[model samples]
Target: MKALNATLPTQGLLNFKNLVYLDLSFSTLHNNFLKDIGKISSLKILLLSGCQLSGTIPAAKGLCELKHLLKLDMSNNDLRGTLPSCLANLTSLQQLDISSNHFIGNISISPLGTLTSLHKLQLSRNLFKIPISLLPFFNHSKLKFLDCHENEIYADIDVPNLTPKFQLETLDLSGQGDGGVFPKFLDYQHKLEYVDLSDIKMKGEFPHWLIGNNTKLYTLHLPSCSLSGPLHLPMHSHVYLSHLDISDNSFNSPIPTEIGVQFPNLYFLNLSGNGLIGDIPSSFGKMSQLIKLDLSNNRLSGIIPQDLIVGCISLFNLILSNNNLQGQIFPEQANCKELDRLLLDGNQFTGSIPYSILNCTLLNMLDVSDNHLFGSIPGWIRNMTFLRVLDISENKFSGTLPSNFVPPQIREVYLSNNRLQGPLTNAFYNCSELMTLDLSRNYFTRRIPDWFGKFPKLSYLLLGYNNLVGEIPIQLCNLGQLSLVDLSNNNLSGHVLPCITAASNKVRQEEVGTNPYMASSPAYMKQPLEFTTKSISYYFQGSILKYISGLDLSCNNLTV
Candidate 1:
């Protein structure tokens, strides 16, 4: 720390009278020595974010001396002090950002409200509090952007005269100390482009004008705000509301058939975690711009909308799990050639999976588990060369798994509780990239395949309640990644390999544990942690956490 402070020769730095910008962010600055830089009288912009500095902010008399300063950014630092009151003296200051710092004490913005040139004020992730009846400090007409989220500010917003009256476009008040009905501030801001008021306990029906008149709004996020009742959509067609996310609320009512009439430009719509019921409107098929749609964990029922699958061709993700949708699989599922993720688990969809979707070359995940799906597993599934996850568990799939069904790139395969009756040689030999393979409760009658050792990446292997006889092979220990092995209730009659048992625990703990690739990787490669917490005693986190079978695995003798 001392080395960095001494390296900045104070001699050459003082004579730079024409210096207009000085950025030393992500540098190893020590202590509260920023006041020394204020000596550069002609400095217009001073940036010190992400610097290793500490201690309270010093008096800003030297900072005020910079009469030509336009912007001052000290964010992402360890600076912990009451905001300097002298900042108001910088009449030329247009933007002030002190976010992600350790600033403490009440943020007295009354001095800032008087700054006629202040256009942007970023005091987020700090410690501040204002009266419930008083509005946030933005009374100046020049203030255009105010980001005070993740703070301790609690106000019911009663002041009508405390208006900024500026052309503010973005206001993020998420994670701040706020409650009661949402503020009627948006009713005034006609030019707002982005607004996020999530994580605040603001309740009441969805505002009519927010959906109706905020035509220029591109992003509208109000998740977990406890807003209830039918979604009262605005009837304006010119409003290009691109993203509409109102998930995790108590809004109960049928999904409006006019959803397409209002949010035609919506590319992302998440109406999950609600009490919404009725079939998805076929009018939603008109939203050609949709890329991701999540309607999971709702009371929505009836047949899945075939129009949605056929219309939105640009879609890549579709999560409709935990609903009451019935009828055969949507015939238009093949239309989405760019589809990468298809999560339709926990529903009542029946009939065979359309082999017509093999054209989606980029397909990575396919989860249709816990449904009423029947018919044989098709051999064309081998065409999905990039397929990584395929879970068809808890279904009535009969006939033998195809011999050419080589899912070399597959990681997880859950085909449990099916009518599969055949030797495991073909399935285990081809799925070399498997991380999990659960073929339990099947009618397969044959000696366990010795080729199982080929699956070097195998972690979970559940073969219980099968008609497999003979000694458990020690060659199975070749699976170094094997963690959880449930070989009980099988017709095996020999000593179990200690290495396999230990590796099975390693695999179980690892699969159930942490995959290091997930610690720092993309969302598709990552796994969510699942454990016993207080509020959620049996909570599970992850994209591929499945329940293959019950606690009991009887019917076959275990000679371990």
Candidate 2:
């Protein structure tokens, strides 16, 4: 006793009369202090975790004075110790956290069976590889939360035996590295609210009992666990489910159209990278509170429902690209006031671009390319001041270039492969924020806009296959940031607009300016003339259809 008192710091020993909590954690104390701690008879909580303390817990013959100790958190310390059989004497301990420590020894079951008052046990982040042997004592117990994650232990999940722990609500057995079919281990987890069994090797289809109607669970994340097969619809509807992510699995089958009805409270549903197919259920619009819906990279088909935008008013992200959908976009922005992103490319939709999209005040991205749309673009589309990206290329659009057609906020514009006509509108020069402008395959005529060099951010401009005459504006040659320019096959004269060649450092030349009619004169005529006969290729067949095949500006008195 005298030697123990000498090792104690000179200023350390304080009054033990009213000491209800003593936390000497991370203090690097040795086993010598374990036997001497018996002197503090009034301690109710002892936290000596991560203290570099090695050696097994001393024999419990002399430490019975701590009868009132209720909490002991000896976690994350160098306590290379064994489960002392004497822990059975600490019957009054209710909370124990011995995780993340070097505890090397067999976890004998006989000693822990008597700890009936234990309510919370955290033995995770350790090297304990023994199969869970506390199955016998858990019957009709008071354990509430058990976290054995990231441990080397292996054990078959026995759910029926754990059904009686009326207080048990959260069970985390993730990162155990186990393999086998996930036992139908949750038949009676009536009170379970959160279950995370991710990254553990659980084969076979996911058991339906984990998220059925009778279950009161709210969060179930079972990711990357070798679970396959189409997820069978749970017989019981999960009305309270809010967050569900079953990504990176082999679950094939069309997502049940009744999903919205089954999980009405679902807010985030991420089924990406799966083999799911079929059209998005219009019923999903019923989830009024859903915020994010990602159905990308699936075999989904059918036109996206306009009701989905109207119903999910709070949806911020909607990704439905890379699918086999075919239909014109339903033009309605009144219901999608908060729609920020709308990615609907790689589909076949016909008809003119809808003018109602201007109402989407918060729209940041709009990708409707690779469709079959026609007619002049509504002027209201360029008025979307907040739009950053606008891609309407690969469609059949015509008419004179609308003034103020480019938004100042637009960074990228891909209007390629369209039948747009008339001279370059001066409004485009005002789009100082433009970065990429691809208007190839259009019928733009006359000299290029003189203010093109004023754009500080213009880097790529592709205007191939146009009947643009006079000369490439000298202002365009002064654009230092212009990296790629394509003006091939045009009737451009005036010394070929110096520095406008394939050898130009920042320019690329390609064949352009195909004529729909066989005429001697170049297109872009300022004077209106009556056509005696249609061109061989019929450029003037439709309503003011002079510009065709990128740009059919032939048979007109246009000079350089």
Candidate 2, residues 171-246, lDDT tens digits: the string is 7667766646663435546677777676776678866666773467777777767788987768767877777777
Q: After superposition, how far is residue 452 of candidate 2 from its true place, in Å?
A: 8.1
Q: In model 1, where do residues sit more than 4 Å from their true spots? A: 1-11, 60-64, 106-111, 129-134, 157-163, 504-560
lDDT of 1 at 532: 22
Itemize residue pairs with steric clashes in candidate 1.
Answer: 483-504, 483-507, 483-508, 484-508, 509-513
Best prediction by lDDT? 1
TM-score of each: 0.87, 0.61
Worst lDDT window (10 residues) for model 2?
A: 524-533
